[model samples]
Target chain A: MISAYVTLAVLLLGLALWRQTQPDPGHRQIAAGGWRQMRPLLVRIPIALIAGSFLAMLVPRELVASSLGDGSGLQGILLATLLGAVMPGGPMITFPIALALISAGTGTAQMVTLITAWSVLALHRVIAFELPALGWRLTGIRLLACLILAPIAGLLAMLIGAART
Target chain B: MAGQTGGKPARNGPPLLDGSTVFFVLLALGAGLAVLLLRGADAFNTALADGLGLLLLIMPIVVAAVLVGAYVQAMVPREAMERWLGGSSGMRGLLLATAAGSLTPGGPFAAFPLVLALYRSGAAVPVCVTYLTSWSVLGINRALVWELPLLGPEFTLTRLLVSLPLPLIAGLLTRGLLHRFSRTVT
Candidate 1:
């Protein structure tokens, strides 16, 4: 974790240096914009974390282990994919829930499927953004084309995990 | 498309205290109450401390991610990206779209419009599909900001490796579907 922080800090410094080299440096505006984007996330993050912690406690570990843990296999992946597709909101919500689930002993492959499905097949996003922006034809085609990807990713992760062990 | 803002706050941008935030706050409160009542004070305190501890651990990383996302947004030449994607087709087009998608920062609001613009400007269907797939699946900004921090390196790396080929496969499948549909229409 300390190493992660150091690496990120170094990357941030490099980005700052790069920004300075630009001819029309709009550092102030960029900083303000970033703050604007981040403000909402700041509010959400703590609450989400607290909620996740409580959830991790409340949820039965035996259930999580039996359903989504190692050896859960295709059934777990499929269930995760379905849950992910229906999950609303953004990374703030999704990641916290994922963390909670992980804490409760959900398998790595299951979480992979869940995140991938949320990213790729989120029904809310498709309806709220994609359909309005890209219309039915493009959205429908894209949805169809990418429908199976989350499960495939989960299966692959499962295979890799099996191989490693 | 050239003058369009990539990550700038739109005129009608969401309020700081939006519906989602309110909902989450309520949910968190409810959960806290439940923990206090059912699990007792000790459990509640423990959970709260754990949450705060995790928050402290990841806060710096999150800040860095936000800064990186912001700077990358400022730096990306949106017009250049549009031009490159607009002029390409076939496998090369899919590759370019994938790169653009991964590199394109911001959320659905920023990305969906770009894909829409590309589609309207005559970028092929497959290319558009690939771009959106890449944005949704392989987004570098999201990986750095959320996935790596939350999921850790091992899970992040494994998921990434498995997801690497997804956009291309989706593009190819889309192209095939389009071909079949077009033939039937004709």
Candidate 2:
């Protein structure tokens, strides 16, 4: 069902792209301007990936799965979020590891926080591209917001899970 | 065609080769091989087995993101996205910001281009903040891929239940702070 929604959304967005690409100058101008502005970040992503991959090698998955594994609560969430920020895996690695951690019996709340931080506050991304592009004020503000919200989201996911079952 | 002379690359093109694609390809291969050698074929096999599905899932997402990125490039004028689900009333603005925030895709990086488009097209500071704050916390993308698989149906449902409201809270608080800051400037 969710996948269907995503498929639908992607298809709609694709159609939107096709429509926008028509002979209108406004859309073309927007695309051109966007490319000019975002070039720096595009240049930065591969560096971040290399760095993230290397870092992923150092932190053994067992430690991550154990320390913040299924049983841990708010504390685990806190730890996992920070760890996720610093540890430096993209969604490709993080998503599966998150599942593995859950299967290993990590708390749902903790997983929620960890995943939230992983996606939003990835240390590699923050350092390599985000801070530079958005600036310290906005970057700091967003990180602070994520820090506060991730735990709550984690808790909410857990609570929701509990209610459903 | 008219602006074809701009020569600048498309912002949404494949990102793999941006900084150092060739190097990373080698790195990914090296890393994979290291696991194969040190941990033997079994360890390499396990990592791939565990990791492959997510990589597959994200492929479509990344493709879609790039395409939406192109559309966002062309259409969806920025002002519209930031148009606050509500007007001036701070609380109302906050609620609207939150709802709007949840729907945008990509992380901060993805939002970067979109937000720039918004600002260029005439978005407010508070609305931008709300949208950005929402992008990080809410996982419309992950909610589709990671959350469903990892958390199971019950947990996935619960997360959507909880996450749906977060942008509102975050957006409101962010707007209030930015509003206060702007007011002081004025």
Candidate 3:
């Protein structure tokens, strides 16, 4: 994980630098904009993760494993997907909770479904961003198309042994 | 348009940290405080330390992710989006939109408005749906910067591979609906 993280940073930094060489006015904006994004994140992500980690310890492992565990099977995946979709906020919020769940003995399939649900069907994103941007018709259309993604991804994870995370 | 782009518009509306940010902070603080009180300080410390460990693992990657987000925003030809993502351009256009949505960084704030602009400028419903579906499913920036680090490569790869067909499927389904609805209207 550390190696992968380092490699990504180095590679992305290279890309940002290469982009900077183009002399476009937007180049300077990248660093400045990046700092702006990071400011809130540096504060928010830690708070979320720190709280989540402790919360995970408090959650009974047996309970979590029983519900979202491999033993729970398809039912667990469905529950996870539903939970994830209804849960608000972006990746910073979701990922930390997910990490806590993983530490709490949640199965890979359930986690996969959870994250997929968050990405595709998150109520907040749809209500806040999608509706305002694309209107009801388009929003409904996209939602309909995405309705099956999470459950199917769960099933696929089971079939392909992606449950090993 | 969100009034965010095309030269910073007047700051007449609410700030970014109004409702959502406050709620999240309250939730976190409440949770942290609850665990500390119930579990005692030692357990609370342990939990935070564990979180710190995980945070350390992913901090650099997260930083890089933010930078990538900014770079993608800086570089995209947001104004010309309609030219490529719009009209009766067919499959090529759909593919371009999908690629842009998945590969392009930034959060909903960046992607949705650009998509809405394209739609307003005459992008087909199918094309727009394809773009949104791709962004949700593929989500390259989040997957790379967050998922890989937090969830690791295996789960991420598996999800990515399984989800590979989603955008095209969504496009086709949406296109089918569009045609059927138009037929009904006619």
Candidate 4:
């Protein structure tokens, strides 16, 4: 599935690149801009990989399985959301940890809630990016409005999980 | 495409790799070392190899996505984009901003600054909120490329369907609140 996803992304990107290259100005600018942004990956990628690996190894699998496993139910959703918000790092870190929990018997709803919480209220993103760029008022209101989203998502997924059984 | 801001980089008061990154890295290292000491090197090596495999898998996607993102961004410079998003009002602006946020694929560094640019140029509070919320929730590229592959299609769809209403609701509420705040202050 991942391979298919990657292939699709690459194909679409190829089409976009081709379209951009059609115009001479875009051709010149796109290459330079892409390189500039992609350059940091030289450093960030390795660090991220190492961090992700270590985080995966360190995650308390027993606790995760027990707290977010099939039997955990509604309370599990809240716990997962809270964990997502506080868990540090980007997708490189989060996804692996989520995957580990899944393998350890955590429910799909718990993982969904976890990722949703991470996406909307990630402490790392807020500290590293949002606070400085968007500021207190914008961040605060956004957070407030987003308060119920993870739980809502969790509930929906849980309903689905229940229906399937 | 992540760090492509204009002029001074949104002065955010702190350096890019602040204490957060260092602190987290240290934490990972400490935990990993303990795991190694207790669980032995085989478990440690296996975990690292898994991370390496994942990195390899996503490397091509990441580069291609970045290039595509840069092209999209180039096609709509901040000045032009900000003008459009800021001038547009009501549901249309909200929808457009949400679409932009959903379609736009880049890391946090690129997005936060861009939204700030829109806000600084007079985009409505609701539009900005919508944009951020949509970006966080929908993140189409991330979901399709990363989540779908990692978690499978079913899981991805479940989450998306559940999160569908988030941006619009957040936007409407934020707009109303902002209007009330300004009206009262004046």
Q: Which predicted model would earn the best lDDT?
A: 1
**Candidate 4 chain B, poorest ten consecutive residues by summed lDDT:** B8-17
Worst window of 10 by summed lDDT in candidate 2 chain A: A46-55
- Which candidate number would show the highest DockQ if scored against the true structure? 1
The residue-by-residue lDDT of candidate 3 on A9-39, one tens digit each, is 7767787777868878565566787776665
The DockQ figures for the candidates are 0.59, 0.25, 0.53, 0.48
What clash pairs does model 1 have?
none
**Candidate 2: where is the Cα deviation over 4 Å?**
A1-62, A87-93, A96-105, A128-130, B1-16, B20-27, B46-79, B82-89, B106-110, B113-125, B139-158, B175-186
Q: Which stretches of candidate 1 lie over 4 Å from their true place?
A: A26-29, B1-14, B184-186
Better of 1 and 4 by lDDT: 1
Worst 10 residues of 2 chain B by lDDT: B1-10
- Using lDDT as the measure, what is the rank order of every candidate, best first? 1, 3, 4, 2
- The candidates, ranked best first by TM-score, are 1, 3, 4, 2
Candidate 4 DockQ vs. native:
0.48
Compare the candidates by TM-score and give the number of the best one: 1
Docking class of 2: acceptable
Q: Which stretches of candidate 3 lie over 4 Å from their true place?
A: A13-29, A162-165, B1-18, B87-89, B182-186
Interface RMSD of each: 3.2, 7.2, 3.7, 4.0
TM-score of 2: 0.62
